[model samples]
Target chain A: MRRIHILCVEDEPEVLEAVVRDLAPFEEVFPIEATATADEARRVVRDVILPRGELGLAICDHILPGEDGVSFMVHLHAQEATRATRKVLLTAQAGLQATIVAVNQAALSHYLAKPWNPDELVAVTRRLLTDYVLETQTNLYPFLSLLEADRLTERIRSGPLPGDE
Target chain B: MSIPIRPLDRIREALQSIPEAQSEVRDFVTGDVLLREGDNPGTISLIIRGEIELLKHAEDGDEYPLGTLRPGQLLGLLSLSSGNASFFTARAASEGTLLTMPDDRFVELLHNRIDFHQVVTPLLLGNLVDRYRRVVRLHLEVAELTRDLNAEKRQLQAAIDELEETRNRLVQQEKMATLGQLTAGIAHEINNPIASLSRAADLLHPQWHKVFGEGIERGLTPMFRQAFELGVTREPLQTEIQRQRTAELARLFPDLPRPLVRTLAQVNPESFAELRSAMQRVPESVRLSLLSQWAATFEAGVLVRNVRVAAERIGGIVGSLKSYSRQDKADEDAVDLRQGINDTLVLFGYVLKKFILVVDLPELPPVRCRPGEINQVWTNLILNACEAMGDTGTLWVCCGVRPPDQVWVRIQDSGPGVPRELREKIFESHFTTKQIACARGSGLGLGLAIARGIVEKHGGRITVSDAPEGGAIFTIFLPTGAAPD
Candidate 1:
């Protein structure tokens, strides 16, 4: 059985270290470039990461120096290899519109507001990956009679379901 | 306004014998021009016996009237700086005796006349230092003024953007509300007809099949009964019937009474008991099928209710946003600080969804203020508190009224508190503590500055302190202007 590979993109050196350290213990964690500018990040992904294989997840920093993190995720979605990567945006800002736009357009797996705890991040990412596994398994057999498995697509697309209560 | 001038005969008598003294006397009337600042660049005039008023006129037509001069003080050093213009123009306020010296002679006396220079140089230097200090202070004030203006401009722009967002939200909400109203109305209208159709279908469906089944059974029942009655009647007929029956029996012999008959009757029974059992199956099967359909109908009802609820939610959200937007600039209404805090919590329901907000708000009377701007105070502080904790931590909001009618609102969080060094400057706009997107926080720093401005505008204050739970706490105090007449 193949496990999902996560690509963590962060701009801050300390934070990048923390993310890698947190995820390395549980899963196959791949660290992308911790660049000062968004251009450098884009170059690193294009020139280096895409050649590896399909990415299962992309953890993006929302505030980067040259270009914003949300735009970068949109770019990632445009790429064939990384389009399926589950996206999570990390931000410290308090306003709502930016968060709404990220969730709406980026189809993010999660939004981890800063300053986030390491343990909390690990828990959330782990849950998301588990959910991804269930989804993949459900999609493999399209002819199955089980509506429960088939309904995952709708549940994910609709965001948080009302029955989540 | 007019005071008599004293004669300085004593000073001249004291300095007359000095060999370096070069002095000339002049007479001045009231309101005479004693010294045109730039005209006599090096001449020092001694006020002998009257009052003098010095004036400085700028190019922009602004005149500065310097204070009155006394008998002992010397003038003309206002132009001493090589690159500076005369500080002001001077004029005699009353008729007076004056002692004057030429520019070159004044210079010579400063070099040779030790006693004269000693008394004069220290006074001049002191005045120069004072003027220099004022100029430096003015420059600093100008820089600060520039920064403040820029901040205000940014604030106004943010407010305008917020206004636009609120307007768009309102319009969208109104449309949604109208659309929802239409959907409900249409649903109500169509439900009656659809229900009637379903009831009619239900009434006809079972009866139509029953009628079809009974007609076929009735036709078969008479034929069987007629045959049984014919076989049972008269002796001769019975013998003939017996022969015929024997032939019939030969055709339908022992196989009919065999186990297959019982099994066939059990599987597809033809007796009255079997017929009743078969008839019962129709209603049971129909009920089961109808139950599945009813489940679907029930789900649809739930969906419609959900839609109604959603439309109402949108309406409620837009209503609050409209209030938040308009309240921002409305007149300074009397505000209950505690109530304002509660409203802020409601306004930031989105944020609270991700974070746990705990309130320890005090019960107090209204604090006179602009509720709209003060609401911004709670918003910024509370948001900052949540952001500091990354929106998943515990937040504590406390409010109370102090003596002399000052109200305070404090919001604390469970994330890392502010560092000691940065506490003072955190309220400065654009400051953030997050690691990623320091410039943007990646977007959390806008609220604190806005909050500070609002509090100050209300003649109140805001500050950040350490929370009891080891995070950061923001405290705000609002001064109630006055009680109603």
Candidate 2:
């Protein structure tokens, strides 16, 4: 089984800390990566997260220093390697049109408005990551307690693993 | 003597019917006077042909033409009625014929013949009535013309008043625009310094704490820690509490100066006994210096927090101003009106602190608009509500989708409701019910007018009505689709 990576991108240092801190509990299952800009997130995805681990989830802020989060999500959706990644937009001020585009074009999985509750963010991240893992991964034992354990067990029993075939 | 052609024929026919009355036909060349002013000319001369000019003599010895009479018109009829001198001189302007009847024969015919009196009396009355009717018609025509002239004058005055109002409104708008530009510039210039000050304060807090807590072992470090802890938990002392604390500190440290004791009291009013005990442990020579260092460190900690708070406030104001003005940006963008309203509230936070404010805004969809201008609309409305409420009242700002394709924001204030008569006038530029002094101090009565302008530009409508909870309710409805160019 390959390890999965969760990426967080934000422009403000303080906000970025809060976001990564909230995801710290899940680091053992999926390593959390941080970047300040969309361009930096792109570099991390291509050069680091993709080569070593499967990119499973990304939490992005809408406004960045260069190439905003929505465009970055669009670019990620275009690439074949990162196409299955779960996208979440966490922002205080994304306009309606941009959110709509992120939903329709990038297949954005969840939206957490800023000043978000830590529990809510963790719950949504877990759910989206579970969906991604169930669709792509061959083994689901590591994420059994974090996700719907019975459903994953039934899937593992009923279907052959991609590696087994 | 001259006569009109038709009257001569009429006189001739009347004489022939009488058989006893006599009349003579006469001819005159041009410039002959038929009747002269102030001369009797007892015989009646009727014009049978040609033209005669009626003239009045001015005191300046110049004859002014009164009118011209052609054939069939009679002259010297005035003498027939007055039996005295004529009032106007009638002169023949061209050669003409006349029939002259002497006064005695005319009188004799009028008295003896009943038929003659009957024919002449009615003809004279008919002529008089016709002249009177002409005069009456002329008076009526003059009255009608005067009425039309007055109406037109009133219309002209109204147009002038409208023009003056428009000019005043434009001048006020120009002043407000200039003031807005100045505010934006000042806000931009202050932003960087505020950020740096807040950052430095954040950085200095931990370092200052570490040095005061551990850098020194014996020289006032422990006292300083106690003072800092007290300062953090203590409520700000009122004047009475502070005075009592100062007195107690002075009594405890009688040898020290009163100001120093007061400063120590301010920093750590609850830790005064501990401070006194610590001071006794130190040597007499270094006692004052240790207490002074502790007081200074405690004061420094409090000052650091104050500076950070003040800097953050300035930063918030600058952020609100930047968003409100949308400086260095194009006019139109995808704008969240809810965010704009929040920014306006932040700008007005100082004023709103005195009032009970309830802002119930759900997540709203963004609309394409001039964000800065829309923000100004929110600012104006919220400020007006605050001003109306004065020192204490409740203000409610509620926003929601109006459904189908529109979004609406309603701002309500618990002030004296807008008067029924003034509801429409309040949105008009320069129309204010507030005193002139208040207007001069706060605004030029253009706030609502400008708000209406901005809303209308975005294909929206603003309305005001009496609120259910007293005061006024102002509702703004904006279309949710792409704005028409």
- Best-performing candidate as measured by DockQ: 1
Q: Candidate 1: which stretches are off by over 4 Å?
A: A1-165, B1-282, B327-330, B338-343, B429-431, B434-447, B482-485
Can you list the residue pairs that collide in candidate 1? Answer: A93-B443, A93-B444, B55-B89
**Per-candidate DockQ versus the true complex?**
0.02, 0.01
Docking quality category of candidate 2 according to DockQ thresholds: incorrect
Q: How is the predicted docking of candidate 1 categorized under the CAPRI scheme?
A: incorrect
Deviation of model 2 at B386, angstroms: 4.5
- Work out the TM-score per prediction: 0.36, 0.52
- What TM-score against the true chain A does chain A of each candidate get? 0.68, 0.93
The local lDDT score (0 to 100) that residue B121 gets in candidate 1 is 59
lDDT of 1 by residue, B1-485 (tens): 43322334745654455546667778889988876766744767766688888787879987787567766566675554453556677788889887776556667767887876654455455545656776798799999999999999999999987786556446534644564455556555655555555455444434433543565432433322322222122112121232234334335434332221211221111332443343355566453333233223323332333333434454444444444433323356665676656656776764664556677876876766766556656776776676676625788888787776677777888889988999778876557665554322346444576677667867888877786658887888777665534
Please, what are the lDDT tens digits per residue for candidate 2 over residues B140-237?
Answer: 99999999999999999889868866776566456546656877888878987987888887777767768776768666566676666554344444
